[model samples]
Target: MPSTSISTGSAAGPAPCLAVSGASGKTGWRVVEEALGRGYRVKALLRPGSEVPEGLQGAELIRLELTDQAALERALEGTVALVIATGARPSVDLAGPLKVDALAIRQQCAACRAAGVKRVVLVSSLCSGRWFHPLNLFGLILVWKRVGERWLEASGLDWTVVRPGGLKETEDDLDAQGIRYSGPDQQESNSIPRRLVARVCLEALDAPASIGRIIEVTSAAGVEPLSLEQWLARQPQPA
Candidate 1:
């Protein structure tokens, strides 16, 4: 199996309070849980009607619409960083992706800027920008996701976009899976457990080199498991 020491040094200081939007989703709640495990205080943000997931028990939960400028800003205030795990679910509504993935992301970026949250991590997907992919059949999700990513890139905050391949819910045997990390568009297909994706998001938060980069991830048993820092060291530095 791929062997590398993963460090939590990115968050070495007194852990900063973290804000996680979409805290009710499969991936979002895990981000909250992982952050709490890493000794960070967490604020979990959800839509007004979102159900409270059990994983959010220790977090401070705030319910509000992402479009509610005032509410979003208020929830983000005092948090040092924000992780946006929100994505439009598959639905009959044809415009859901435009509203949730693109528009909502723009709103969140504005709120982050207003709230002075300097660091933001966005959980996107692999093949996000392609128009011909099968995943785009649902409200053109991949297209909108790319739109959201572009907005974050221009948002003037420290940002990292983690684009993971098909997300699996399996938690067992995760320790045996080694993450294969690459830069944007490097990998088009594969799968990773949601749990691993969560850990990578937190790891990216602590790894300064992850800023302003789009990291693609997938995993399989026996693949080399390198920390985000180690993977980053192999890439050319940003100009």
Candidate 2:
């Protein structure tokens, strides 16, 4: 593993509070924990019936349906940024992906606009727009995810899309893995720990250069780890 220290180039002064939606999920909970560890006030938002994971205890929790425009806007109010970790689970219902990945994303973007939350980091998946991938068997999830990403890109908010590769649950040996970060479609298949993905989300929040970019991440032993700032500086800026 490479050195963990990477300059974030964070703006001068105190950081504002952040909101993390889908805080009860595997990756979502970790994002909340990492933000708290970094000394930022956090608001954990969840669906009305979602379980409150033990890891989310320290942060303020709000429960509401993402489809409820008014409630979603209110939950997002006063937060300077939002990290959208919401994702559809595998289900027999074929429309699940369309609703959760696409429609729900549009809802959140509308709420963000109404609530004045300008910064957003969305947890998307690699191969997000592909039509032939096997993952699309789950209701064309990748297609919907791509639709969601497009909505955010056009939302006019300061946004960065973190498209992580296959996620793993193992926390052991994390220090041995270094992240490989690149722009969209640069990498196709690999896996990364949820913890590293969570860290990148926070790092994107701190690094302004991440705005309007789609960053894909995967990790493996012997790869040099670079901070999001370091990686972004090396990419060509959008015209």
Candidate 3:
């Protein structure tokens, strides 16, 4: 483990720093954007080959492989929290899910521990852990994602697993869409915009009740909008 620490702030004050992995991806960049918009200083972590997106312009970018323990730890050091938006992409490589969804999550958990980062939020899918799902055809992604979620749960850190339904790229009419959030595998079929997912990730960070919970989300025109805190308040504590 490396002893590197990110500078918090000097003259202004101590602004909490947030590290967002997979920052170049659609969801990752939005998470960074939302974090910055919420007044948190952000460190956007991307792969070396990942093309920098326009959304990451305001944040500090650190390019490194997640498998590089030293670099990962260095990126996470001094950051108050981390949002893991990394997921395996569809490709010819059959092992992509196992490597990215499972192994990489384990690696990130270890790095967070070594870096002294206490808070973590993972972006997973709605049907995660299901063996008979259609999405599992892509390298058993749902299964691997579940494995990753379990590892994070047992990581002994303040963690939240956000499993969203089918992701939509459209950012239009966001205000009209209300998010339906449930506990664990409640809602298996629906869709949500990536922007909404980004907002919930940040919301989970602010809500202490979200820690150690698996929040499943989806959106629609008629669903009533509610903050993560509001929804958490209505649910019974996990036994």
Candidate 4:
């Protein structure tokens, strides 16, 4: 059964800080912003040269390479959970996906274990792991994304993989856009605003039942609105 409670650290004090990797990215900054709005301290992690976007203004910024295990672990030391919003951008370098999507994830998982950050949420993509898809032309991105997901799944940490469809930049009238959630591969093509994707990443953190599951998301106007907990409640418990 899905736990109804949302953890705000221990009963004794302030909420544990949340660390969001790729904080300079479109979705990452939104996750950081949302976390802050929810009253949690946030650490926005970015690469050394990544620009500080306006969306990340209020959070503590830590700049470091994800491959630098020492630096990554240090940045995560005081954080209770890490939301991985990293993804390989389309670039001339064909190896970008392999490095950013796969190897970087392995490094983050290792860093999390070292830092004792037990909970993690990974923002992935729909059709991740599919080979024949057109998106694979770009460095076999989907394949590499699946590699990343598998790494987190086997890391022995409380983790949730949110695979959203083509991301949109528009944030207007978001309240009317209802998210359609499903198990892995159930959602193939559609689009959801990046803001909604950010919210679901945090929502997964609050829903204990989200652990060890891949939740695919897409949004449309007529779909019934449901929180992550509500959707999880309707599913059969894992045996």
Candidate 5:
């Protein structure tokens, strides 16, 4: 590996392959499409019974549950980096948050180490480490999400945690929205387009400064969408 460091918002080449889990979800599919549009190869990891979203057809698809160690390892093989877009879908089962958010994160980190995939970007949530928040009502989801973020932070892998505010489904006028980037525990209570969140995940893969850092993001109209590199240069690194 000749110099793994990269300026933010850029990947190595036209073929810098990325493996994306939860590729069946709306956000996951968009992440795959954006990666492809940017000229990077992508391996989409879906579940055994996951419906194949149309946009993901051209990319390499790997199907397996997160608990399947052999399949997980093989799917992540040959990828330089990974973006974890998996999240517990809204469910009546209260334990879904812990199982999918925290435990699954630990499993993926282990697989990354085994497969020699050193760079990872995690899609975390706002107020993750907080004890008193509404989302936590869902089986202490905020607490568990924090656990997941901590797992990646302590895993010793090159990692970045992107904590986005409330998610939205709107795509039109997205170009008019600018991502408000901040350090961990900074901004909260605003929403960002899922497409922008996907872009930030890919951007972190190519940003050396992004590693070992927690970046909070939310978007709003009337603000200039700044590049991650430009934002990073303006802030003092966490010490």
Candidate 6:
């Protein structure tokens, strides 16, 4: 059976139908697995060349190139929300970040619009717009990521940007590692598990307060874990 039923989530309600575009990556796979564990129906979208992550074996899979708008439209059909776990995997090609990170996001937003998929949660980096950063050495990635975020900003869609700190892998005791959620640029450094990032993405879909906002997240072992609703309630609303 699919991991999470299309009826339950971290929020204690029926899970939403989630379409994840980068279901083959380490973090992407975790999001799919976590979503399943939480009772959500997942549609795993991937490029044909992307390696198949073993954990994603049971997900409903859609294979296609990002530039193929028709395929993107087809894959997103019936998806209640789109969780953009896709990113420019580190590579030798300098243009990969721009094409995949910036332009790809624009394409997905366009397809979402065409397919009536209104709610979108983008998995972005913590330092998305900064020109100076070590991660940018991999292709000026941060700059391109910001470009992608801007595209979504202008797409006229209901969107949330989950700008996470450096990604880490850990499934143990996530509830104990409280999340520090802040408005865009409120934070500059930290790390979080891919699983938590996925949960936050699902959380944002139902949070009207999250729309049009750029939320940065990081985790701390010493901090008491806080739910998205709790974090959001305490932060200023997006203007």
Compared with the true structure, all predictions reach lDDT values of 0.91, 0.90, 0.91, 0.92, 0.86, 0.84
Please report the candidate that would top TM-score against the real structure.
4
> What are the models' TM-scores?
0.94, 0.93, 0.94, 0.96, 0.93, 0.90
Clashes of each: 2, 0, 0, 0, 0, 8
Model 1 quality (TM-score): 0.94
Q: Which regions in candidate 4 have their CA more than 4 angstroms from the true location?
A: 1-6, 9-12
Candidate 1 residue lDDT tens string, 1-239: 11222243464566578999999999999999999998888999998899998999899999999989999999999888899999998889989999999999999999999998988999999998999999888999999999999999999988999999999999999989999998888899999999999999999887888889899999999998788888988989887
lDDT of candidate 5?
Answer: 0.86
Candidate 5 per-residue lDDT over residues 1-239, each given as its tens digit: 22365332465444667899989988899889988887778999999999998979779998899988778988888888889989998889999989989999999999999998999888988888889988887888889999999999889889889999998989899989988998889986999989999988877766677888899999999877698877877888667
What value of lDDT does candidate 3 attain over all alpha carbons? 0.91
Cα lDDT tens digits for candidate 2, 1-239: 11222232367656567899989999999999998888777899998899988889789999999999999999899888899999999999989999999999999999999999988999999999999999999999999999999999999888889999999998999999999998999889999999999999999887877888899999999998788888888887777
Ranking by lDDT: 4, 3, 1, 2, 5, 6
Off by over 4 Å in 2: 1-15
The positional error of residue 139 in candidate 5, measured at the CA in angstroms, is: 1.4
Better of 1 and 3 by TM-score: 3
Q: How much is 158 displaced in model 2, in angstroms?
A: 0.7
Residue by residue across 182-225, what tens digits does model 4's lDDT show?
99989899999999999999888889889889999999999999
Off by over 4 Å in 6: 1-16
For model 6, how does the per-residue alpha-carbon lDDT over 1-239 read when each residue is reduced to its tens digit?
11121235367655567888889987788878877776778899998988888878668988999899999998888888788889987789999899989999999999999998887889998989999888889888999999999999889888889999988888898878888888778788889888888888877765777788898999988876788877777876544
